[model samples]
Target: MPEPPPTADVSTALVTGGSAGLGQVIAATFADAGYRVVLVGRSSERLDAAKQQLDTQPGRDIVTLAGDVGVREDCDRIASTIEDQFGRLDVLVNCVGTSDRGLAGELTADRLHELIDQNVVTTLLCCQAFAPLLESSRGSIVNIGSLAGKVGARYLGGYNAAKHALAGLTQQLRLEWRDKGIHVALVSPGPIRRDDAGTRYRDRTDATLPASASAPGGGTKVKGLPAATVARAVLACAQKRRTDVILPGYLRLLIVLGNAFPRLGDWLLLKFTS
Candidate 1:
């Protein structure tokens, strides 16, 4: 692989949820581009697998940390480990999140809390833990959001609430830290086509919607975008210091329409989505 541009001085990126899905691709892309990358995940096995894959980028530095970012103690350890190993962090990618599709009434309190802890709390804790290092480096943060964050969809109440909270936090941080020389941006993508059957959630529960509503190429027939697409968009966002990026471009229209016509948006979403 070719070396990164001479002008690129930023190094060291920490990506949560890097063991799989879009997070894995993002870590690989950064490593290939010569960034010292750290992959954080809950599963040691998956982290090891991801590290092995990124290690193929000759001469690139890769570290795998197995811990849950949703837990404060784990986040502290992760921050300390990065600071001790790298001395400074140039980028922080908050890619730790999960998705679920079920009617609000069907979701138990425990399930709702799980979604919040997995999605919203994980992002918040990581950001809080790493903010000091990023501020010192005058670095950037790229948060992975979702289209559900911008506009609610059928049978995704808990996920939508959590992602929307994440989106709000991203914007608030962007403004709050602007003067501190920390650039914060959000990358919100629609359904992402994972290598594993393009399923949204890692597991299917009894409360989940029918497979037709949850699987890619099922109801709406909208084939999800490749993971690499979002990874590249993240690179661009980091390089240009963009404020927000909604993937596939056209989804931006949905956000606008949803806000401008709430009733119409609800009708459209119901009519089109399974």
Candidate 2:
């Protein structure tokens, strides 16, 4: 058998929403690649399961933090835990998100607010609380955004708005923290896939999902991507400290053309995406 490559002793990570979906893949990818992982989520059982799944990897530290990023104190508490245990955080992946579907006049203001808190507030809280730790090692932050924010998805109105805000936040943080030795990056991917599909975009909040359910836009039945592919995209951006990245090829064009002429892009999107 061939020998595997060696990993660096400096590798350490804190992944929000790391119990499932893309966050799960991100955690596993880092673990398999030999980074000590701090998995954050709301459910202790789910966190334990995720830790167990990666237990086969030796020389890797796995810490499960069960808390809400949406709450300020919870974010502080999680940060303290990381400080107490690891003393320094080398990488931080923000995968906390929520989605609500309503078309035209059907979406409510409350739902809009929920989506904002999920996509914007939670990320801000996490980044703010971890700034000190990330600065200690000049680590990077990888925020998983959505391409829908680049264009528009009709029924995903609130979701698109929240993610749009996240894109802006990504840029603001990257620039403001650049001289502070903290690298910030955003990875805007299209609909991501997982082997065991679950309630991914069910509501406008990051509420507890059922044991099993369909993914957004009936994607559960569609032939879709593997979570590992998205994980690799994240890895590429982190290794290079790129400002931002878009996946699945098609989305990148949309990002370019959309920014160049947004109105024209909106017309095309409504015409075709519908």
Candidate 3:
């Protein structure tokens, strides 16, 4: 947990998927740092839990709205509610995303589309509805990306493709919002444990004994960086208005290097998982 920042003006923030995992941690950071934090998520139970946790702070305003940003109506409704209540939004971090991991050819057309819609359409819609408020307040937007996006892996075709597309969206949005003083940045992360039923166990077991042979890092005894690491990266980018920040700095460096010399990435990924 981080100490609250010294600030007189309490800027408002809306964090999508703020009810759990990385989103929850990021929301806590904003609330602690003197922001009026609004958490958006699909689960009413989780949202209430998040709101209660955030409001426990002495000098904080925490709101929870149960809505899926993937839906346009939901995005519009939340945007309108925020504008009516807060007058301004200073930070918008989109951490709501879903991924379907399957080999490219194994996916049905519908599942493939769902993956794209879940990752790309959802973020685009949320940003679209909130752009006016962000532009007005010179707010910041952080999109969570992935190492898989930067460098594809076996058996994660749909997830990898959508994430790669998200990386593209981050770059384009930064350019579009640059002159307006609205910061837009991307945070690329290695896989982190998502808090769903048996997700952690499943990931660990699969990592140790992958179906498709052994990925190099697969057998390397890796723990996906904790979600807080991601929250920290988002915080750094938001505060500094950086164009891009990669989680676990070393992984970021490797991704960049992998992009230039793909074989190196392939070799590293294959060897470690094995």
The lDDT for every candidate, in the order shown, is: 0.82, 0.77, 0.76
lDDT string for model 2 (26-81, tens) is 88888777678899999999999988877766766677999999998999999887
- In terms of lDDT, model 3 sits at 0.76
Give per-residue CA lDDT, model 1, range 145-262, as digits (tens): 9878877776664888888888999999999999989999999887777666635442663434566655642334345789999999998898789998997788688768878999
- For candidate 2, the per-residue lDDT at 110 reads 85
lDDT of 3 by residue, 100-210 (tens): 544576667887788888888888999999999999999899888776667776656477788888989988988988898888888877656554532433442334335
Q: Residue 40: error of model 3 in Å?
A: 0.8
TM-score leader = 1
> Which should have the higher TM-score, number 1 or number 2?
1
Which residue pairs in candidate 2 collide?
none
Each prediction's TM-score versus the true structure: 0.89, 0.84, 0.86
Candidate 3 lands at a TM-score of 0.86
**Highest lDDT: which candidate?**
1
Question: Where does the lowest 10-residue lDDT sum fall in candidate 1?
Answer: 198-207
